[model samples]
Target: MIVNSDLTMGEGVIERHEVETFLTLAEELHFGRTAATLHVSTARVSQTIRKLERRVGVPLFNRTSRHVSLTTVGRQLHHELRPAWDDLRAAVQRAIETGRGLSGALHVAFVSPAAAQLLAGVTQVFHEHAPDCEVRIREAQADQILPRIRSGEIDLGLTTLPLDDPDLTHGPVLVREARMLAVPAGHPFARRASVLTADLTRVPLVRLPGHTDIPPRQAGAPPATTAPTAGTFQEALTLVGTGQGALPAGAHARRYYARPDIAYLPISDAPALEWALVWPADRHTARVRAFVEAADTLIHGHGTTRQPPQ
Candidate 1:
């Protein structure tokens, strides 16, 4: 069992500096190092630790002429206090952000033309909710979206859904576009009303760098060993337009990227492509949550479809 310190004593309450010194000394175990890290004198570090030991009624560290290490009680206290200290700091930071009324910059990005158009509507609504918060928007290739979000380069991303990565948090499915097959306009499949999953066996599929939801080579499909790779959705469509390969695309592409040489047909057996707001798993900040709420409002309240920009 652990003895509780009189942390709540009136007027005699333990100060923040005491807790900081205790945790730091517990981690560093060396008096000089702890003092250097806290920018205080070794004597001050010794005084703080002694005061804490007196308060706890036990020594927290075992000291020798050359070695310093945590006592058993010290280990227990560190185990309990470290996470609590982190949570306390985080709560204070959040309070600061909230106190400032969310009046800061929110960085957002979109992965596709359809996503960009939809983001335009979300941004308008977000502004209504957070007038002082500046929403900075950018367009990124599909592969760049997750990296930017993870590295804190961007706060949120509007991109394809069903990301299997554990580090990413996918928000609600804000937009759903029917799956379509983009074939060369003069190809036989273009004259057909729709294409089946089995039909993919006969056509080479273009590879979009980071789009994982597209169908893979079907059971008996020819090996895509020599398939072309596209950096952007438009590039993928262009590959299809040149008869290099067929592309599985969202229905919105037919409207936003209409081309004379490319024909889009419904995929009779494909699932709709889902789009949502994605952010780093550890970065669900107030601004991120607020932006997600705005997006939810746009999709549910307004029933915004993935249509070409008006």
Candidate 2:
């Protein structure tokens, strides 16, 4: 018959290490090996098991110097504990795998140019691997993208820098792209390898209305002329095609809207424009994970030109 002991109840009676030792030994069923696994000597494993038995008021194991096996009580304990431990292990593994890569949807938002240029390849790769996952892309301005991300209206965003908010996580997806001077085919600059920014200073310049702040050059190219302003890429493109003035655009824009009448010349000396990928700090869902992975893989496969800025 088992007897209860008052000494076992007060405060510091059952040591957690003793319980852990029992479970570990039970798993291995070998004193010396269990001891080695636990980084302790067999003597210590024996002492710990004895302590646990006394505290539990039951024999947990049938033991002999040659072999150790579970007693009736030990078998009961194993039956009860095994499933719980298995569950814990499964949960931990799931968490790690989810952290690595798993099934989910990812919503992406981008500015007009980025939407047109970068998202297609990214979506294609993501869908190929995660066929069940869904991707939604929205086009908005820098100001509009962040608010939606903050409000949980979007999962990820691509935009230009100067994001000072601490609630958002952002990384450079592409470095400043050299601005290309886009003109009509008959334009003189179209025949040249590249055009100087200074050459446009006195020329009629078609500019994005609200984006006057955007730098006017390709890498270190000369400065270009500016008309008062035009809003949106479509507006700027339209004005340039009509020969109103030259428009400065990123490399992607030049290729996306390649027109028979329009010609794009590289700017010789302008500061590049920065492109970045951003997401909210607190948003973590399977879909978001899928999107981030797809974006990463797409960026990687594209080689240097498509590589995200470090």
Candidate 3:
């Protein structure tokens, strides 16, 4: 129970359940929906709301045969209580986690072989730091990273940047590797010492599903056209090998995804590809922070290489 100085007597107190029920009902505006959301019966919801109204000394809602609307007082209360409730819940959760000493499950996902290897290192260090916490790691395709994070299926993602989404938070850059162009072994570009960004105009670039930052072609070159979209990095590399298109890949691919049919040529003028950890902006918990700290400790303190081993 919490005391509300804004209440009628400046001494009104309400149970935690009562606050939850009231807030849920206020948003739903329907007893049935509120009950379903709260996993309680409609009778229980009604009883709770009535008790809250009595305590507040006002009819907080207007109800007729077919409609439910919050009164002026109710609207003001909801406006003020929502943020306060969120803060209270967050505080309690932090308290519980601190008391328990970081001993629960944390789900993390990574895209690409390079990311997987880096995550492996980070996980080892994290386990050493928080041995009681169970770390679950999964591999996801490039396109599946954001959706899984948003849906709460994964607590963190290690993937390519720049992720401009405001809904997600990016961790410190863990790997920065030179950009390379992947082409068929017999392709002209494959035999060159290096390639240029303008060379992208000569052939269709194999497109990754969610990538929008295709290298810009040189001036006076024809505008780039739509290319085949690949769901995974392997598929993109396969497209490159089939002579359908070239792929812009990180230097790490040359080491991890070596293929006889494919050749990786460094892009002389292209900026390095950066890999980082990402998670939902609102879901940054102690476990997530701890894992990020582990990455910092590994890379900055232990002299972890910025690029995958050759």
Q: What order do candidates take by TM-score, descending?
A: 3, 1, 2
Candidate 3: C-alpha RMSD to true structure equals 12.4
Backbone clash pairs for candidate 1 read: none
lDDT of 2: 0.69
- Misplaced by over 4 Å in model 3 are 1-95, 98-101, 216-222, 302-305
Candidates 1 and 3 compared by lDDT, better number: 3
Report residue 62 deviation for candidate 3 (angstroms): 39
Span of 10 residues, lowest total lDDT, candidate 3: 1-10
lDDT of candidate 3 over 178-209, digit per residue (tens): 88888899998877999878777777888898
Clashes of each: 0, 16, 0
lDDT string, candidate 1, 170-289, tens digits: 788887777888899999998999988768767888998887547544665565433598888888888989999888877877888899999989887877778889998877777888
- In candidate 1, stretches whose alpha carbon ends up further than 4 angstroms from where it belongs are 1-14, 17-95, 98-101, 216-226, 302-310
Q: How many Å off is the CA of 216 in candidate 3?
A: 5.4
Ten contiguous residues minimizing lDDT sum, candidate 1: 1-10
Instruction: After the best TM-score superposition of candidate 1, give how far the Cα of residue 81 lies from its true spot, in angstroms.
Output: 23
Error of 3 at 191 (Å): 1.6
